[model samples]
Target: MARLIDLSIDSDQVIQHLKHEVKLKTVYQSILCKQIIEKASQERGITVEPEEVQAEADQFRYDHKLESASQTLEWLEDNLLTPDDWEAGIYDQLLKKKLADSLFGKQIEAYFAQSKVQYEQAVLYRILVPYSALAQEIFYQVEEEEISFFEAAHLYNIDEYRRLACGFEGKVSRWQLKPDVAAYVFGAHPREVIGPIQSGHDFELLMVEEFIPAELTNDVRQQISSQLFDEWLESELNHLVYSQ
Candidate 1:
């Protein structure tokens, strides 16, 4: 024979709140995503300072017009989250970003060092002649070197931007050009005609008018560093997320 046990009754309001149901699997996954973030954050020696959290929370509240953090928590809970979950998400994001910075920060400096000449500012004159009978005629004139690139551009180019600057497209980076274009622009002796180059549906002629090498400008290094960090973060995050 077994003995029966009785449980105490709670107030109706308490019972109603307690009855709020959430999916077991969702709760479990939320816990897992939370743990991953915490572990990653700890590995990086990052602390989500109170002021920072508060600032984020304050902004969240202001954006959503929520009364307080507590309300925010309740809303999150209703959407299947806890405060821990939110904090973990934030921690993971910040820590991942920081780790990326630490990892890729040096590479950016190296990149800037090696590619400084490639980022040199230049004034270019270009003529875009459609693939037609006129193309060979224009190409011949430019190739003969009898007429200057500027003269050819003024005579035959139809692109309005070229017309305005007397065919000058100022301050371009070699990396910004297509592989073929970069080769031509950087490989040529300065002031030489570079192309009857195929570009999309047209043929182009280009000449480098002037070039200014990239100086060690303020914040340029930082900008490159930040970009590198972002790239690293994306790669790392992709690995992490896909690994599981």
Candidate 2:
């Protein structure tokens, strides 16, 4: 028998190329998710389905106030897509949502029970005034109660609309606020005014207008549950495919 010569490329370089190719293929498959959706749609005998497509297209038009589907198609063409590609994209999104629902619907319900505390809301107020002489003046006036928070914010805050609204950040959870802001707002006594504190370039003043400790509202609970299930499923899928 003839001896086989080991003349192949270096094992390390081959492995690196394989890894790189896998990464590239992952990106291509993400693009091809739309193709998968188009194929599935056709397989389900959903042809001549202009009504469904039009409903989707109409919603997109209304949301964006586009004049017609042809106009939408033109825009997509400019961006390197066809009308069918747009339909495929929509179908792909719908299919993924259905898959998520099917796979984790029960898990999501269980998650809602376990994660109730994460779903509460709170009432908040904020003022973002320019970090200038006017802001400092407004801060002092509020501090001394020389002017009402609303009055000072209306006169001096940089953001025109919030100034009009008297700086109502409205009901927001601790997670919604920046870490530093959340810490101060949630930890402070209710109805307490906090800050001339820095947020980016501006000075922000916050008050805990009202506090509502976590309550399991159906909508909020469902959202939290869905998120938790998604995270768990992602981890499990990753492990099954890639774990050593």
Candidate 3:
């Protein structure tokens, strides 16, 4: 390893950067994931085809708007990656995807069927206030028809974007929210006002404007497949008992 960077960078700064990079949680996970994917690929006889690699490279070039081979080379230089490293990285990614699909593809439909409620989305309006008393007051006002949820949110909610949007949170699935918040929101009837529920440091009043039941669209199925694959990876990683 002939010092990845030149002498222009201070020795102490380079040491510090290396130390920080190695210690990052994402870096650790990426290394573990690579190890797991390689093992799985071997066991399952999964492979990266030349056509697949070329297709991925083409898509990458299109995404980065690299109009020519020179531009692609410039990008590799800027990223400190050689052509071999770039192609190997692409192969590793494709291998992982192939391995996951091969291992978990058949389980997706069953998993989706069992956990479909987690994917159901709710269109919501919320009024969040710092104090429990304020949240309760807003809830009462809305309940009594003295004020609408949107009006109260505009007047008192601390989040500026939500206030401007009249407290609309667009649509969110149960898995997208904190456990406590999701429990209340998903269980409540549509158009029913609910909550003075504690959320972190703030208290919130939420109303479910509408609920969108989960459907097994192609996109959703793919998402579910990825989720299952990730969960399997985590469990596999956890059970590896290493000894020096």
Predicted structure with the largest TM-score when compared to the true one: 3
Comparison by TM-score, 1 against 3, better one: 3
Model 1 C-alpha lDDT per residue in residues 40-74, reported as the tens digit of each score: 55786866676676677667778888886678877
Q: Write candidate 3's Cα lDDT for 1-244 as tens digits.
A: 2234563556567667767777555656678878988998998888888899999999999999998999999899877788889999999989978887898889888988999988898998987789999898888888899988889989998888888988988888888898878988888988678889888899888899998989888878778878888888888877762521
Error of 3 at 150 (Å): 2.1
How far residue 215's Cα lies from its native spot in candidate 1, in Å, is 3.4
Alpha carbon lDDT at 177, candidate 2: 68
> Clashes in model 1: which pairs?
none
For model 2, residues 17-107, the per-residue Cα lDDT tens digits are 7687777556544455444434545666444345666687678878877787677876775555667888876655555555445556567
TM-score of each: 0.52, 0.61, 0.79
CA shift of 43, model 1, Å: 7.5
Deviation (Å) of 64 in candidate 1: 27
lDDT minimum window of 10 residues, candidate 3: 1-10
Best by lDDT: 3
**lDDT of the candidates, in the order given:** 0.68, 0.66, 0.85
lDDT of 2 at 129: 73
Q: Which ten residues in a row have the lowest lDDT in candidate 1?
A: 1-10
Weakest 10 consecutive residues of candidate 2 by summed lDDT: 1-10
Clashing pairs in 2: none
